[model samples]
Target: MDWDKLRIFHAVADAGSLTHAGDTLNLSQSAVSRQIRGLEESLNATLFHRHARGLILTEQGELLFDATRSMAQRLDAAEARIRDSKEEVFGELRVTTTTGFGSLWLAPRLNKLYEKFPDLRIDLMLEERVLDLPMREADVAIRLKEPSQADLIRKRLMGVNMRLYASKDYLDARGRPEKIEDLSHHRLICQNVNSTQVSAGSTYTQELLTYNIPSLLTVNNYFGVLQATLNGLGIGVLPDYILADFPDIERVLPPSESREIPVFLAYPEELRHSKRIAAFRDFVTEEIFEHRKNLHESGDT
Candidate 1:
């Protein structure tokens, strides 16, 4: 099989138009059409059904597409591995992490790493939703939850303690809630507009108490919640590291009462041998573990 022709087919299928595929592949539309025709003749199957809107994949094309996507991804990974072998910490490192961790901690530390390895390029993708590692959506991920998927290689970074905190102004205005039961009287701020993980028959309201807050103002992102809490909107349940820099916000609850969120550095098991991933994993472990004290002490916990 001609891999080049197969690549052109894949590109056309992806773009849904020969002209767009040609634009992507830096070829003429007629050239792209010729390649597709050649691919169909070679396979002896009609890969696409032409419609007024665009080319729709035939059944055979769908099957071929599934296989081709996998093949292309593996080929790209193989190329990346070879490129990584030829260099020392030089290549794009795509990483996904939560907003709080990315902004407060990881973003700051990455500068030092970049300084040490100038050749390396880093892509920090900050989002609450974990990227799909098995599908190769991201090269690496720093997550708060343990990855249970069999194909992922996960390393525990540290056990992060999440505690309730409030600015002095908010605490003074609403007064302190000495017990968990007293929380009802004060306004609480909840982060992440959508609930984390809803179990069977659970409502949106039910998940709030799971984090130990009932009535509250909810924000869609972590930074919004942090800023709102700092402005004395209400008490917020946040990771200890996030509150480290804000001296005005005091920990409302003891460490024993807080929730322990485990942090993990995860990558696909297949890419475990990649030098870039190994370097990042080791760098994160060394940097975070070595400065664990400062991270903890910076917070009220």
Candidate 2:
């Protein structure tokens, strides 16, 4: 019931060690232990199971921790809102997206963003896992699919297809496969079936494997597949979004592509008024517009 005690308990539960929690809270270990004991006494609950390794949450502690975590997120949202009142996009903005898109697409274009907001500190988290925007795990997300999370402002950024591509050097050296069946003679570079990718990409890879390609180079992410293909390794199944930055790679078997994968940019609805979020969202939207225009001028269908 005490907000200060709840805060201390959350820190201790998170760190799983009184000493570590003490260090974070700027309190002595004894002080932190006393707070935890007081909190437990007030609720008549055993919050943690002490062990040689660290404190493990008891059943009651788990429930309390969940409540504390929610409170922490709400407080984080409030803190972010307060920071945004300065009307400056000059603070930490945590962005999340897939490694392929982040590295090949968004990361390269970030220089323009930096040029505009020189003081902005962007923590770009690149992974396949979808971060919780509403919970403040990330400030913004560019995902391969729509985020189903509630209380989020979602925008469709772009569409991508899991299409086959090969480096010009690779195609020249090995002879490009003209048809899907011709893939049997070439090495295949793709994401492993076990990898965390959109369903469309995995489904496309699965369909390609049916060709019974003799040689294979499967990586956990598209970035690896891109590098391998760049080195003249094999035909790689990659997203079409890479084409804007990497036109040197030639599309192979253009008709053999996967269903469209929708790319979405999302943030918490609560972040609607944040200047950092506004700037970032506008930057991304402008980049998408430019990309589409270039694709059109280049006669891309």
lDDT of 1 by residue, 1-301 (tens): 9989989999998999998999999999999999999999999999999988999999999998998888887887777778767658788889999887888778878877877778888889998786888777789999888987669998899876656778999888889877766677777776543555212112322443655554678775557777888998887766677655677888885642345668899998878778888888888988876567666566443
* Model 2 stretches astray by more than 4 angstroms: none
TM-score of each: 0.84, 0.94
Report lDDT (CA) for all predictions: 0.78, 0.92
Candidate 1 Cα RMSD after full superposition onto the native fold (Å): 3.5
Kindly give the stretch of ten consecutive residues in candidate 1 with the minimal lDDT sum: 197-206
**At residue 222, what lDDT does model 1 achieve?**
57
